[model samples]
Target: MLDIKLIRENSEIVRDSLRKRGDDEKIQMLEELVGKDQQWRQSLDKANALKAERNKIAKQIAEVKKVGGDASEQIKRSAEIPKEIARLDDETIALKTRVDEILMRLPNILHESVPVGADDSANVEVKKWGKPKEFNFELKSHGELAESLGLADFDRATKVAGAGFNYLKGDLALLDLALMNYAINCMVNKGYTLIEPPFMMRRSAYEGVTDLADFENVMYKIEDEDLYLIATSEHPMAAMFMDEIIDEDKLPLKYVGFSTCFRREIGAHGVDTKGLFRMHQFNKVEQFIFCQPEDSWKYHEELQANTEAMFQALGLPYHVVNVCTGDIGNLAAKKYDIEVWFPRQGKYGEVTSCSNCTDYQARRLNIRTGKHGGDKKSVPHTLNNTAIATSRAMVAILENYQNADGTVTVPEVLRQYMGGKEKLGKV
Candidate 1:
């Protein structure tokens, strides 16, 4: 959530950001919020004035009684004042509720560096790493190659759980674990504490981490319960300090989180439905950080560098894009997507997202930082990046490393985790 003070003081900045995002509806919502907020302030002032008047009337009533004069008129007027005050109080509460509702739904302000565009097509490529490998023979899709090598059972997975699911068998299952282990070790070596967050979170806490639209579009809710399966480890890790204040000395709290995420993928369509590229369940290693506001942009680049190094070690060809305003979504002020080369698709697919959310999540979660036992406090900035989404990484690996002989050469970094096996072949 944006700071209401910022919105009130520099509304044109917010308006310009929404315009860049092409979000006219929210522009109108902002106007509504401003009007309602002004009304709420006015109503509160009236209520406070009435309260002061009532106090004065009470004093007058007591003075009249002390002098042995009739106090009936003063007492009667004081009683009537309370009824008016109560009515104004109710109006003030109602307006506040409306303002807060709109505030919660507003997108975070965009950073000046973000590209102005309508969608992903306008995203600017910032960097490219490694080269896309050339294949002499026709390449098979990751799904087909995995099945031909007896490394996965998509047919059975589909029969049991419908589409958008899969079962890894033999060496392929080991590869998945290897990916997670490799990512965890890489992040840990970089001074990020490893954490395995809860796979589920309550709606209230979830709201603090992501846009509420995810409730219907992305999240999987538990039946008859207030819990929702987390869409990413970032959600739980970010919410860990919700409604709490951290000491300023711990300004930079970094964590590498691991979790099996669940998503509904509602309205998703295309060839990815038949493969691991898009799945309902997947394991991910996430990098999350909480730091002072001034340092967030620096940490954002650092997070991107960490993911780039991992991909380089795994020998995956990829490129980074500075996400455009429209594609950056509601949470992050600015974002970068790491798109890995897929030989079969003849293109790059997003395997990681690095974002600097600034103080958006902190404000929504009510997380703050202050001196130990001190009264002063301010919201800290939050950031998250995908170290590896194992499923997509595996897709990239399978397509890029497939040999003409139907074997998949294991990336050198993952070989140790896969029992020193150099290649994965038919079971």
Candidate 2:
């Protein structure tokens, strides 16, 4: 959410930022908020004036009574003032609430460095790592290779659960665990504390981290509970410090969260539905950082670099793209997406995303840091990036490391985690 003070003082600046988002409705809502804010200020001023008048009249009544003069007129005037003040108070409160709701709906201001574009097509590739390996033979998709090897069973999973779910048998399950452990260790070595948060969260807490529309499309709500299964570890980790004020000395708090993410994956019917690429439930290692506002952009790069290093160690060819403003979404001021080359698809697919929200979420969550003593507080910047999503990484590994003989070579860095196994073949 934007600071109301910013919207009030620099509305043109805010409007220009909203225009960049390509959201017409939100721009109109912002205009409405401005009018409502003006009315709220007027109402509050009137209420204050009435209260002041009441206080003055009460003093007059006391003075007139002390001198044995008629004080009934002063008393009646004071009584009438309270009723008017009450009505104005109610009006101000309603207007203020509406203004706050609109502010929360508004997207964050984009950083100047972010690419101005209508969509991902305008995103610029900033860096590329490793080259796609040339294959003499035709490559099969990860789904076909995994099913043939008995590593993943989609038919049985569909029977037990539904479409978009899979059961990993034997080595494939172990590989998932190994990938998670490898990513977790890599982040921990980089000085990030690992946290395992609850898999479910309440609606109130989740609202603090995301837009209202996500509640229906992205999240899975429990049948009879206030909890909804988490879509990413980032959600829980970001909400942990809701309404909190940290010390300034702890300017940068880094965390590596591991969790089983659940998503409805609604509207994704036939796209990568049978593969590990797009599943309803998957394990992921995510990186989250809370730092001073001025340092978030720097930390954003650091987070992206951390994800790239993990990909490099796994020997996956990938490239980093500076996400365009229209594709950046509501939470992040700027974003970078790392798209890994999928040999079978003959193109790059998004594997990890890094974003710097830059106090956008902190303002909504009321996460702040004390400036000095306990007197003043300021919102801290929040960022999150994918360290490794096991499902997609597995897809990359299955396709990129596949041999002509139908064996998949494990990345050297993850071999130790795989019990010294060098290759995965038909068991």
Candidate 3:
């Protein structure tokens, strides 16, 4: 959520941001909120004046009584003041609620560095890493290769859980774990505290981290409960300090989170529905940080570098793109996506995303930083990056590391974690 003060004072800046995002409806909503806020301020002023008048009348009544004179008139006026104050108070509360509702839905202000564009096609490529390798033989899809090597059971997974699910068998399962361990260690060695956050979260907390109204279709709600299965560990990790104030001395809180994420994938059309590229449930390692606002953009790049390093270690060819305005979504002011080359697809697919949500989430969650006793305080900035989504990483590996003889060579970095195994072949 944007700071109410920012909306009230620098509205044109906010309006321009909305225009850049191509959201006219939100612009109308912003005008509505401004009107409502004005009304709320007027109502609050009336209530406070009535309260002052009542207090003055009480003093007059006491003075009259002390002098042994009539005080009924003042008492009557004071009694009437309470009723007026109460009405105005109720009006102000209602207006404030309406204002907040719209404010919560408003998208974050884009950073000046973010590219102004309508969609992903306009995203600018920052740089490329290793080049795609040449294959001498016709390549099979990752799904076909996995099944052919007896490494996965997609047929059985479909029979039990429908499409968008899979069962990794034998060496494939171990490779998944190895990926997790490798990513986790990569982050841990970089001074990030390891965390295993809850897989389910309350709707109220979830709202602080995402636009729940727009994101509901992508989330799985727990039946008859206030909880929803988390779409990413970043959600819970970012919400960890909701409604709390941290000391300025502890400015940057970096965390490496691990979780099994679940998503409804509603309306995700024309994507890989039968393979590891997209899934209803998957294991992931996430990087999250909470820091002072001034240092957020720096941490944002740091996160991207960390993720790219992991991919580099695994010998995966990839490139980074600066996400355009429209595709950047509501939370991030700016974002970067790391796309890895897939030999079978003859193109790159996104394997990781990094975002810098500068005070947008902190304002919603009421996360602040202040001195122990000083009055100065401000909202902290929040950021998150995909260290690795094991499923997608596996897809990249399966396609890039497939041998001509229907086997997959394990990445050198993950060999130790896979019990020194060099290849994933038929069991």
lDDT of 2 by residue, 45-144 (tens): 9989888888899899999999999998888777778778888899989999998889889999998888888988999999999999999998888888
Candidate 1 deviation (Cα RMSD): 2.1
lDDT by residue (1-427, candidate 1, tens digit) is: 9989998999999999999999999999999999999999999999999999999999998899999999999888888887898899999999999999999999999999899988889999999999898899988888888889999998899899988788898999999999999999999999999999999999999999999999998999999999999999999999999999999998799999999999888346465435788889999999999999999999999999999999999999999999999799999999999999988878887899999999999999999999978998989999999999999999999989999988899999999999999998686
Model 2 residue 374 distance off true place after TM-score fit, in angstroms? 2.6
True-structure RMSD for candidate 3: 2.0
> lDDT score, residue 269, model 2?
40
Q: What clash pairs does model 1 have?
A: none
Q: Give the local distance difference test score of model 2.
A: 0.91
RMSD after CA superposition, every candidate: 2.1, 2.5, 2.0
Candidate lDDT values, in order: 0.93, 0.91, 0.91
Candidate 1 runs further than 4 Å off: 55-75, 266-269
Residue pairs with colliding backbones in model 2 are: none
